[model samples]
Target: MKIKTGRRVASALGGAALALGITLGTAGTANAWTADWETVDDGHGVGIYNGPSSTSGKHGFHDLYTPDEVYLICWIRGEDIANQGNVWYRTSEVYYYRIGSYNLWGNYYVYGAYVDNYYAFHHRLDECKS
Candidate 1:
């Protein structure tokens, strides 16, 4: 009977350890960036803008290299490009760029045309409050 009790205790401890590990693992992932990273399909690179419109001289602060993955925070309806719709995704992560002698990094907006066509579907992205 003593040997059986010892085995039961060990089994219980192992189960507890497993549960703790799972909890910790999930917690670790939760701390990571919550947005999905998508690749920019444009081979020539795409411009990262302050606003959704490319025609806006105030926007397009930096250029995001093509085939790079960007963390999209949300979406908004703005100027249409290449007849690809007016959808745009706002990025949450900073990108590095050089302007003349200075290097700069900032978060910016990307047109949906640079991303997959699937993103054009309605409700595919969380709309930005702005």
Candidate 2:
């Protein structure tokens, strides 16, 4: 009886150690936010905005050409374009035609209608606050 009780106690401690090891191994190694890539509308490069709306003014401002990919950060509701949904995506970076890729400093917006996956990310992306 004594031997069986000791075995159970050792097994429980081993399980706890394994769980803690896993938790510590992954700590601080994951990104705080999720990101994905979406291609720009073919032949129609779009402008990057400072805010969710076009009227928000351009921030770190630049244009993204068709075939160019935008690294999406998140989305928010904004002014409508071409009668399309009033949605816009916040992008982190863009590539210029003649220049190399540039980082938008993380505070820029692109009209959803201008991206190929405009409809696909509506539910997948986390909405921007305010």
Candidate 3:
């Protein structure tokens, strides 16, 4: 009976430590910029102006962006993309993908899957941006 009680206490401590580590890993120190992101209204529908607010929308997506950070938008650039097309325009270069639904904020790799709710996916993320 005593051994079982000891095991439960150790398990609780371990679980608490694991949760704390995950929470700390996802956050960063304070900065002038807002951790909460916003979408830019450029008359291009879902296009976002991600530059630092202090810069007046210049020199953005060029510096100060982390790879793990993700944003969603819908816009037309260069050629018209196909349903399965994955191409990058000016921002974020060739790595950008027009994804649907499933969140890829954790370096998710996708292949050979057809998504029906592309617009809905964008709308979901766009609304989250405030």
Best by lDDT: 2
Error of 1 at 105 (Å): 5.2
TM-score of each: 0.54, 0.61, 0.18
The local distance difference test score of each candidate is 0.52, 0.58, 0.24
Task: Give model 2's TM-score versus the native structure.
Answer: 0.61
lDDT against true structure, model 1 = 0.52
- Per-model tally of clashing residue pairs: 0, 0, 0
Residue range 1-130, candidate 1, lDDT tens digits: 7544543454344335434543211211111222455665655556667677887543345565543445555677899887878887766442232333222223456777766553632534557655
lDDT of 2 by residue, 15-111 (tens): 3443343222221111223445566777566878876687888754457766555656567778987787887886655544334443343446788
For model 2, what is the error of residue 51's alpha carbon versus the real structure, in angstroms, after optimal superposition? 0.8
Among all windows of 10 consecutive residues in model 3, the one with the lowest summed lDDT is 107-116
lDDT of 3 by residue, 30-113 (tens): 221211222222222222132212222432222221121122221222222345443211122112122211121221111111
